[model samples]
Target: QPALCPKGHYCPNGTRFATQFGCPEGTLSNGVGLQDASECELCPLGHYCTGVGIHGAPRGPCSAGYYCLRGATTRTPNDNVTGGICPAGHYCPAGTSEPIDCPNGTFSAATGATDVAACQACVAGRACPTTGRTAPGAPCSAGFYSPLGSA
Candidate 1:
């Protein structure tokens, strides 16, 4: 006979409190006949959850190009994709899911740069050349003299 499995818990077989266990800290699920904790999926990045999930449904995902933390829910939900932005003078290449800084010779003033190509080279005359890491802030700020590799 089928056991009386409760919501927010899983019943692999004929069992009760002796076998049922709460969902792990990073996962959630619902329904009956659940076999293992693996049925509870980890909350995706850029999202959060407050209480245990009613069903095996994701709370949400962060917007494109923006990063969101884990386990976000109604109280801690994201209003926009402004969780964080790839700072200027850095790049977030499409190849990887993480953000990276631009090389010394190159710099970028744009936000959410999703590729190394967004990094702009410090120009001559208008701006000093960049060396590495320390990219020019607005083309050397006029008076600050910079050689070919100013970054």
Candidate 2:
């Protein structure tokens, strides 16, 4: 009486006239059959999985100005590597890893800058009047003046 036993239940060998069978322990028997369970897999690069048994869920990637470390399981928001973004009042040159302060008289109009060229300099005939001054239209010193008022 093989039909007497439910699917996934184990039946002893040579029991053609079996009337009872026991389900295996430590295994799932959903009335289908015995099968192995799938294991969790690591997320691919640029993607992160936060939970177990994640079959198909959207993953987050490192945003601009940020980098993911090797074997990273979680990412910090707005976190950056040692050479990620240019420091305040500094510029990160093309293809370089660190930020550099703009020259004495130069000033960066924006933060997180990438190049020295973006730094605006005091126009000719106008003076910075002081060190680390950022405003471009700073009036000229006593000895200098913008005759043309060009900026």
Give the C-alpha lDDT of model 1. 0.51
Worst 10 residues of 1 by lDDT: 74-83
For model 1, state the Cα shift of residue 24 in Å: 12
The best candidate by lDDT is: 1
Clashes, model 1 = 12
Report the alpha-carbon TM-score of model 2 versus the true structure: 0.34
lDDT of 1 by residue, 1-151 (tens): 4555554555555456623565554455655656666676555565444455345655555433444444434323234432355556655432222356677766676776666677776655444344324345464555666555345
Question: For residue 16, what is the lDDT in candidate 2?
Answer: 47
Shift in Å, residue 68, candidate 1: 3.7
Task: Give the C-alpha miss distance for residue 72 in model 1, angstroms.
Answer: 5.8
